[model samples]
Target: MTRPDPADLHPWIAGYLTPYTGRTRQNATQYLRRWETWCGQRGTSIEDATRTDIEAWRAHLSARGVRARGIGAALSPVRGLYLWAAQSYLITHDPAHLVRMPRRPTRSQRPWLDRHQLRRLLDYVDHAGDPAMRAAVHLWSLCGLRPAEPRQLLISDLGTYEGRMSIGLSYRKAGGADRLTVSPPVEAAIRAAVAGRGRGPVLYNENTGTALSKAIARLRLIRILDAARVPHVTPYGLRAGFITLSLEAGVPERDVMYAAGHSSSAQTAYYDRMRHTIRARAVHELTDWLDLTGTPGVTPMSDVPATLPP
Candidate 1:
């Protein structure tokens, strides 16, 4: 089948994406604009874009100092756009689909805070200068929430059962919505943070009580880590610490998966990999079953004859 004209794209795409295009569409548009600029600079029409052109663009991004992962992120939208255009018959050939995405480098395992470090960090936050900042740290460290989750939390999200506290979290993950149940310590910190406030987000600026931005979360977390003299700690590190601590404390993987609202088995595996305690335990169990050390009266490897006795 012949490809449709590139000029026919705008209207069809805009309508096709209407229902799905809130934050994702906005980001996709920005990426598409960049792709357009690159094509224009090369004196190529959008319809004339080819797999080679996409590959060149990936190389160009890398040459301009973009990281492999960043290149992958930027190209993701372009890939989607071409696929969508193909599906709508706006393009006969999906050049972006033919193009190989840049390989993402393996990220090092994030360093999780030990129990002592977590305690120290929490203690510092408990006495920090700004009440909101203190509360933010408490929520992340104690409750194991992603940085943005706390800022999105509402008053009605909190629940109590038999005097024990818990939080109901509605969070966005893996292109979908998932919910989490917060632990008691996390609930207590949240309650303390918003004792007087009636509604809206739980963690906010002390001066305005407005939602916190990702940048603000990073800055505050960095400050807290620095004050506690904990190295290599990010907001995500706190989450990893929580998973690690939970597994160490004998929490089942299934329970952790439910509590964290993980949507996929792969995500659960990633969490397990991050928790060294689980990895260690797994190795120990395997080694015990393997019986690497020979039993009594059994010849060790060194004691065995070099050649089999006839």
Candidate 2:
């Protein structure tokens, strides 16, 4: 079916997406427009959309081989719309209020460098990498930044938070910003990259005074890894390296979760390869309350007077 103009169907889309940032707003607009096209086909206005109409639309998307995650992403805006409409007094009933997003399929643990391999990669970059590449690598590998983060960071994002060196990032997976404490290596790399400049891209060319393109950053990393004789994984692997290695080095998982900007422990665990390997049983914790001393002060369950107490 030909796509219809989203605005003709829903004039409120622009206002609804204002809270989202960057590509998020763009993607949400796209999702809602597709939904509007679907609504046009069924001759149902969004204001008059019923729960059954939403479910049928979900089924339609599913029939076309859209995965659960894609379906969920497409539907997210509709849920937001009803809430917005109800609060704005545009609709009395929320058709999407009870509609549940499809559960995402379980993700396999992603690739990451082990400590020794990562050290070698870092060493190579430090010795031969251009200033921009070195800083990007350190931010991703040491500070657990997303691939886009090191590329997009500004010099002003660096600051002192609670007496610790902090890197403030505005581009996060969930939206908003995060201020992560930096490791010494990350601090040194960032300082060197942004030296003598008050406010500009953190990863910029010395001669050009312009930010390094994503291609340049990625290409350099691949070459550096190859020269260092390390397994070549995508830039995301560098962040996974940070999380996996941090947990292995005895940094608490909860702390890693916060630093990595994960919404839940499960998201952090998905990036982990070391910690979940079972060294001890969780069932062992059940025995923590056990008094195995056989002291007479603790009555045996067989001799308990439960009936009398009642």
Best by TM-score: 1
Query: Per-residue lDDT for 178-242 in model 2, tens only?
Result: 88888788777888788779998999976666888788788888888889999987788888888
lDDT of each: 0.69, 0.81
lDDT of 1 at 283: 93
TM-score for predicted model 2 compared with the true structure = 0.72
Query: How much is 136 displaced in model 2, in angstroms?
Result: 1.0
Q: What lDDT is reached at residue 156 by model 2?
A: 83
lDDT tens readout by residue for model 1, 65-165? 99876898888877876787788788888988767777653332667788888888877777776556666776666666676677777777776766666
Candidate 2 stretches greater than 4 Å from native = 1-9, 18-24, 41-44, 48-66, 86-89, 97-99, 106-109, 160-165, 170-178, 195-198, 206-208, 278-310
Supply candidate 2's per-residue lDDT for 38.
80
Root-mean-square deviation of every model: 5.3, 6.7
Give the clash count for each candidate: 1, 0
